[model samples]
Target: MSEYSQNLRASYEAVWGTYQQFTERNEALLRDILVEGEDYYAIEARTKDLDSFEAKVDLPEKEQKYKDIAEVTDLSGLRIICYLDEDATRVCEQLGELYDIDQEHSVNKNEQLDPDQFGYRSRHFVVAFPADRAALKENARFVGLRAEIQVRTILQHAWAAIDWKLRYKNSAEVPQHLRRRVFRVSALLELADDEFSSLSVSVAHLRDEYERKVDAGDLSIAIDRESIDIFIEKDVDLEALVALAEDIGYSIAPNHPNARDPYGGVISTASLAGMSTIDEVRTKIAEVVAKKEPRLRQVFEAWREPDRPPRLVVSKAGLARLAIVLSVEVPQAVALVEKLPFGPKLQSALLDVLRNG
Candidate 1:
């Protein structure tokens, strides 16, 4: 290695640990922001090692020479891979709020692309801890160290990873005959990313509308996962069944394994009982609770472990399933139990209880 490069490597080795510490702290801060309810693919942090630092400094595209290791912005790097493009944008805004961004150096590669050009797109931010944060003793070592944070959606990340493997950094770099194929694949991924983001917004809107309708006692909304969630939250009849179980000396456990997909269980129970609408499901539940509370209690008891105490505890979905069983024929009720989230051994025991009674 050249003397200049060797000196730079020694300087890097001296501060590489500090860069690692900086990225670690910054990653924690970023994770705190994400835990506010954003879903992400990953949050990764790294301090460039001597080899990577040397290669980066030697890249032909670098506009100027780095006289010192500190001049490299990406000695510490962190990446936030999100599930949607909109999530990437939101995270970038949040990052700006938490860090002092070098606006002149950072770029949104999506906006930088020309109308005809295709390349991997990401939001690259050159940032350091804000003054208020850096002023603290614990953060003093990171006062002048800047890191590059890249925010990109999963699809954007996929394209970049494969594109790197292809050794074509840009559409223009591909052979002329293959350029069209490369651009087409890149465009498809970009379009899929956009469609995914749009579909997420649409789903959120639909769920909100479902909540509004279900709250208003509009049972005409057909039964589905989102609608059923709202129904379970608001339906008085389901609440009554839960209360009935409690009054019968049984605890209604909402956190049971059967509650893993309470909506799916509800849907299956309703379907098996020939109920179509949320209205029908609620009507049947009310009817069963009104006339067959005794039978429902018996069914709940049948679910108890023979080796355990006499008092019974049932999942919310389990109680719902029992109610549905009373509303349907014996054969259909057995079928519903067979589909229960319970394991096969308990299912067999429950079947014996049902058959004997």
Candidate 2:
């Protein structure tokens, strides 16, 4: 080993601990930031290993221009893998806000590709603790050290991995005949990424529109995951049934294990019952509230005991589903009881009330 190489290795080794700590701290911060917003795929970090560091320094003498190890901005690396392109962009913006970005070295790989070319697409940020943070006693050690943050959608990350395996950094590097085919594959992935982003935005807009319509009493907006949620939140009949059940000591546990898909379960039950619009759901629930209200209490009492609580706990959404099932005729209601999300004991208690009524 050359004296210069040994010295460079030692320099990296001396700060490797601090770099490791930096990645851990920053990774945690990134997780907290991302958690406050939409869901993300993953956040990962690593300190460049000794061999990888050596490989960079051992590049041909002409290419080995780093006289100081600090020039290597990626000695510590972090990756934020998101589900959508807009999420990746949002992460990049958050990174910029949280750290001092070295704008000169940082690059958006998406922009680097011309319209006609595509291979790798990610947002790379060379970042370090900002002046204010670095001035803090605990952050002083991370003052001068920088880390590379790579933000990419899962699709882009997959493409990058496949591109790495193919050993082609870009379309320009491939043989002329093969370049066209590679570009085609790359174009397809880019299109899929854009489509996914578009679908995500559309879903968000639709959810907003559904909530607005449901809040405005527009039950004609068809039943769906979003509408079902807003409908349950605002539905008076559903609330009334839940109040009746609660009056009988039946608890509404929104976070229970069985409550995971209360909204989705209603969608399924509503489908089987042939209720397509929120208005239909409301009317059916109101029917149960008016006529079958006593039967609903009977089902609740069947599950309760003299000195004990009810064996099965149902959520408000569950109450809506129960009402919908009981609204149908006895034979159909009995058949649909199995479709509702309940354990055997509770379903049996519910079935008894439906059939014996």
Would you list the C-alpha lDDT of every candidate in the order shown? 0.78, 0.81
For model 1, residues 1-357, the per-residue Cα lDDT tens digits are 456666778889888888899989988888887852365779888888889876666666642488777778888899999999878888888887898999988999989978666758998999988889999999988889999999998888898899778978765678999989988998899999989988999989999998887778788877777777777777888898888778776777664443446556668777767777878878878987787456655555666666866656666666666677667767777877876545454465557656676
Q: Model 2 has how many clashing residue pairs?
A: 0
TM-score of 1: 0.88
Collision pairs in model 1: none
**Candidate 2 residue-wise lDDT, 18-107, digit = tens:** 888988888887888786236468887999988788777876772447778889899889998888888887778778789999999999
Q: Which has the greatest TM-score?
A: 2
| lDDT, model 1 | 0.78
Residue-pair clashes per prediction, in order, are 0, 0
Model 1 misplaced regions, further than 4 Å: 60-64, 248-262, 305-319, 344-349
On lDDT, the candidate that comes out on top is 2
Clashing pairs in 2: none
- Look at candidate 1 and tell me the lDDT of residue 153: 89
